[model samples]
Target: MLSTSGTIIGIDSSTGACSIAVCRGGTMLAHFHEDMTRGQSERLAPMAEAGLAAAGLGFPDLDAIAVTRGPGSFTGLRIGMAFAKGLGQALGIPVFGVTGFDAVARAVFATEAAAGHGIAVILESRRADLFLQIYTTGGAPDGPPVALPPEDIAARLCQEGAAPLLLAGDAADKVLAVLDQASAAMLRSSLITAPDAREVALIGLEMAGDGDIPPALQPLYLRAPDVTAPRAG
Candidate 1:
């Protein structure tokens, strides 16, 4: 492992936001967050530059980079990954990839450690379905990520047993609405709406300390792109 004093940077543009964070050891040095479902490709670099400037660091000074590789918007994931990998390659530093699901789950796990119940990190797919994953209290995933219809979430959680469900990510409210009042009572809303770069920084720090290398930086897609070429007009 590099010196604990080295700085780590994390990025999240896997959904509607472009977020950048700089951290040292286990503490956040700086972060920039903004929501723009479009134009992430344009905003990412400037945001990274400004965030680092705010933190009084530069790209060359960066020790590692963490970017969310997701089961969210395809274009958004592509933009984020391209920028992060380019930066990491240029700086010759390790680029860590964190999943959107795990980012939210890990954040909630930190805040609600007493919740032996479990956390569901749901990413809104802008359809009747959602990109979802469940994490036990210890922060390890209970299962692999899957694309699930929002209507099925409540029943699916029930299938997992009676552990209280802590719902997080931007689509939490939709999942709650699908449940009956009694079942809804079993769910507790998490403070995070979407996974933020601040949490990503802390996560990167933990991975670094534990000497765990995250997955390779790439777009993690749950579904095919909505666009396709028209044939034979």
Candidate 2:
């Protein structure tokens, strides 16, 4: 008989999407999601509580807490990390970090294959740039994520070889405009706007089950914060 590994909570408050999930081993038991334009601090914890309740568990019953570590909205990232850290510390359980991009990529790949080309997941950064990454159909990273000016991303896509690409994430609509023009004649595209917390939870549980927990869980901030104070003239 397989021994139970207890429950895990996956929290993702990245982009405009916020979600919580409960899982055991690699199976997701319950999930909650919301499209919050503001107030993640207010919603995340309650959502987590609800998800745990739905799974018939509580914070004390969780074996681990997993969260999306950035390359996303700074406020959202901080809220998620803080909540996970506090919960884990209180319960004396381990807390792990997964990338926001990777979480969305996993959800997309779980649904389809990148048979002809590659996949790109884009998340809107409140700046003039977009957060983007390319991945193989099997969820392997093709390259590091970059915060690029919208036009530059379009140019790059046009230059890449003709392969059917799948696009998804919080910034799907904005990214689609450029991608559509770039790959207008050759590439095919599909969009999934939100990342699934259930998928994130399952992936996190799998990693934890494999003893792949890293000591430091940090968010993937691709660029400096937009609010830099100008030097005095």
Candidate 3:
């Protein structure tokens, strides 16, 4: 029984950046974002508290919590999920999970930026491969998200034919670098390089308005974490 009219705080620590936004009735009341490759665990809670303070609210004032579910840094995703769920449980409210792709795509479509162009979301994976997804001009996903190297992503875009395309996400530059001049000619860069918690909040509000129960929160891992095993001492 979620309601958009109630206060909501959206959290996103799924990328190099971590952000939180407080919104009421679909309008943002406060937002705080910081760019960092690590330390999300330390910064997220304080940022969330700051957002609530700026909005003149407290934990008890929040009606629900919204958080990005990932396709991002493994540790960052876990930190965000745990924070949102813990807060929700303590407050006796629901926690909604939104994918990083959906958060960015919804923001893009809202601005009408992809009106006549295809969209390729190029999220950084911090590895040789990246999390990628394509979308039609109409804002529908062209296909499922996949983990691919920059070269393969460029090849896939080329194979889609020369419809003007918009390249988004934090890794757009990485993908753009590998595209040849001809392919590059048809592509445009979106201003949204990272998923913002403000957008996460709006999307969450929409989810609440839809009147369906929110799915469980889980990290959207596109690839296994890159870890090295220690040799026996």
Best by lDDT: 3
Poorly placed runs, candidate 2 (over 4 Å): 1-5, 113-116, 160-162, 179-182, 228-233
lDDT values, one for every candidate: 0.81, 0.76, 0.87
For 1-233, candidate 2 gives per-residue lDDT tens digits of: 11237688888887787888898876778988888868999998889888888888888888887888888878888998999899989998888788878787777676645454577787788788988888875568878899987777767666645346676666656655765643655544555665556766776776777765457877789998768788999
**Candidate 3 per-residue C-alpha lDDT over 1-233 given as tens digits, one digit per residue, 9 for 90 to 100:** 67669789999999889999999996889999999999999999999998999999998998888899989988899999999999989998888898899888877777777788878888988789989988888777887899999999988888755567788898989988998898787788899877889988888887887888788877789788878999999
lDDT of 1 by residue, 115-139 (tens): 6768888888888788889887677
Question: What lDDT does candidate 1 reach at residue 183?
Answer: 81
- Backbone clash numbers for all candidates listed: 0, 1, 0
Work out the TM-score per prediction. 0.92, 0.87, 0.93
Estimate the overall C-alpha local distance difference test score of candidate 2.
0.76
- Weakest lDDT window of 10 consecutive positions for candidate 3: 156-165
TM-score of 1: 0.92
